[model samples]
Target: MNHARKVHIALNVTDVNRSVEFYRTAFGVEPVKWKPGYAKFDITEPPLNLTLNHQANIEGKGALNHLGIEVSSTAEVLAAKQRLREAGLEVIDEMNVDCCFALQDKIWITDPDGYRWEIFMVKVQDTQPDLTVPQGQHLQACCRQ
Candidate 1:
């Protein structure tokens, strides 16, 4: 079928219930479908089809550095921050921070599985010099984290 205007990501989580709760809070919406070991969230704002699959013995980082939604305006970012806060999740804010070659206003939320989700708005866009990483350092360090 036509899948335009949407992005799909399936994540393997150790706990289905916990992931469902986390995503519900993060997206400000419940899963459109939920089963014993699977949950799917169809988010409209950013048009995402995110699914969580219950899996044991997850190896490696499993969770990546982070996932983010680029909002249209700062107002939208603030609204998202408010919604996540109202859901009783600890939200961290990064205002006017230069990251990823752009000036951004953003907030961060961590799921129980240690996956980080960022809600941000691009305030200014410009070419930024390439950043070099030091030995034994991770890419996250240069990401304005």
Candidate 2:
């Protein structure tokens, strides 16, 4: 596999400082570029180019579906969960859960703008491609054992 470039995403936030703090705590890294009403994070291992730009018309701008970071190990997932919790952020943990056709251990965190961020580690690959989760239950909420 020749994955060569980082994924870039720019988000419009009502408050830049708050979002920066939240992402900094969640990713355990500081933004490579930070300025008034703008910030950029150059994540290496995950290869993400995340940017937050302050805007007055942030509302009614269509919500982001969600964002996720896939890690390599269970320990990494647990560490990220702990770090988020320590930063006074609400984290929901799902261990050994099947989601998106893969078994994973993950933690979910919602940002100030209601953008959900999931940190996960895949443990198993699913052979079946069923996409139906139960009614009133989400993929993130499927790990109740």
Candidate 3:
């Protein structure tokens, strides 16, 4: 089987500078490339690529549904939460939470456009037989209820 490589996430936003500031404060990194209407950050210490683009109708488009970043340990997750809070950003904690048949410790935040983002540490992987059902059910159930 071919191995999957790196993943890049492109996010559309209303203002590049504001989004850049939010991400920089939240993730503790600076964009490697930045221009008038675009910015890109290599969040590889956490192994993720984050890109931001400026557009007029970012809110109307609903460009970002939600995205997740998984860290190495629960301490890292809590640390991230504290950092965000210190920057005057709201961070939602969901520790010991069951989702997709596995237990996770996580924190949630939203960007300026109200796009949900999750930073988490996976403590256990579930060996469930019905993967699809569990995945869908968990996403719906966990956030709402």
Candidate 4:
């Protein structure tokens, strides 16, 4: 038997309305479901489900951790980049970048609440030895203490 499941990601925000507006403008989609203090957007084209909830305090909640959306092709990633830039959101290009021992073409952006989000296409997966530079190469270690 083959089964499929939907992915849902919930993000806490100070204001649901503001977050909704940002997401709507950025993704070019409206939330299919919305209620007081809660909203759900079913991003159709990319098949992502996003939920936003109002919360006064998110500190120490691990809410700032990064999340990513992987697309099928590099062109899609570039399209998203253009859309995001046109919406006046801060879009960063990390094209042909190497991270976690894999090569990817990606864009990184931060939401209103400062959570890092990455939209990327995996160009190739690395199987060779890690090429990451050693600590202190850039005057400090890359990894945190």
Candidate 5:
């Protein structure tokens, strides 16, 4: 929303090769550059500069809560779910879910290295959650992140 045109994320992975494969399926794009212990994906679909680094001892690698790609429509989210499922990856679809003071339609997936990623589009912003379930059944408003 500022002057930034692309978002860059450098990840520490236990195995670059495996992470590359996971990302390839997740983003539906291959790495533009690859080298020993490193791979880079210059993605255009989401305008991301994603890189994978081989970390011999990356303790709490998955501790980095989660990553996400925010799309513009629910249809795009469904399309992503379809594409990800076709790639043999496990996808968790959560539609019309309220979280973080907003409602969204999203899908979740885990990479080979335990990184949780989501593809989501916000539906309603700055509104309180309003589902029936309670206590861990759904994500409550905590303003996380």
Candidate 6:
């Protein structure tokens, strides 16, 4: 896949204009193409080609757990969080969270029509499991797996 320059994602949205605005703020760039019921974004930093398709039925989102952009460092994650907040977008953040044997920092935002997105960075690749917690300690949603 070295020849592939970017990954493409087509999302079904209830309102194209609204979604376009959200993405415009999220990506900090205007769409390369835009029109009624459709918009396209060529995101350079994350190497993503994202599109919005107006759909009457956005309920069946098709096995999509969530969408994410992975960054290189915790500072990058915090920078993304700050940018998102300054844009007046509601952001939920997790810092130094241990999940799947990795310590990660992440910021989450939900787009119009209810799609979740995350900008994240893994601080540590692998971490030893903690033995202090009692058995059956509830797991955070990200750590469920």
lDDT of 5 by residue, 16-133 (tens): 7778789999999987655555556869877886767555666855524356676778888899999999999999988888654458788988899877777877687535324232
Model 3 misplaced regions, further than 4 Å: 1-64, 127-145
Error of 1 at 69 (Å): 0.7
Residue 137 of model 6: what lDDT?
A: 30
Which 10 successive residues of model 1 have the least lDDT summed? 133-142
TM-score for each model: 0.50, 0.48, 0.49, 0.48, 0.49, 0.48
Where model 1 places Cα greater than 4 Å from the true spot, the runs are: 1-59, 127-141
| Tens digits of lDDT, candidate 3, 14-75 | 76677888999988998765654556576756667566755567566765535767677888
* Candidate achieving higher TM-score, 2 or 4: 2
lDDT (tens digit, per residue) of candidate 1 on 1-145 = 1223445455767776788889999999998756545555879987986767655546775743357666677777799889999999999999999754458788988899877778776676533434332333222212335
Better of 1 and 5 by TM-score: 1
Of the candidates shown, which would achieve the greatest TM-score relative to the real structure?
1
Q: Of the candidates numbered 3 and 5, which has the greater lDDT value?
A: 5
Candidate 6 C-alpha lDDT tens digits along 62-106: 534356676766777788888999999999988878743457787
How high is the CA lDDT of each candidate model? 0.66, 0.65, 0.65, 0.63, 0.66, 0.65
TM-score of the candidate numbered 2?
0.48
lDDT of 3: 0.65
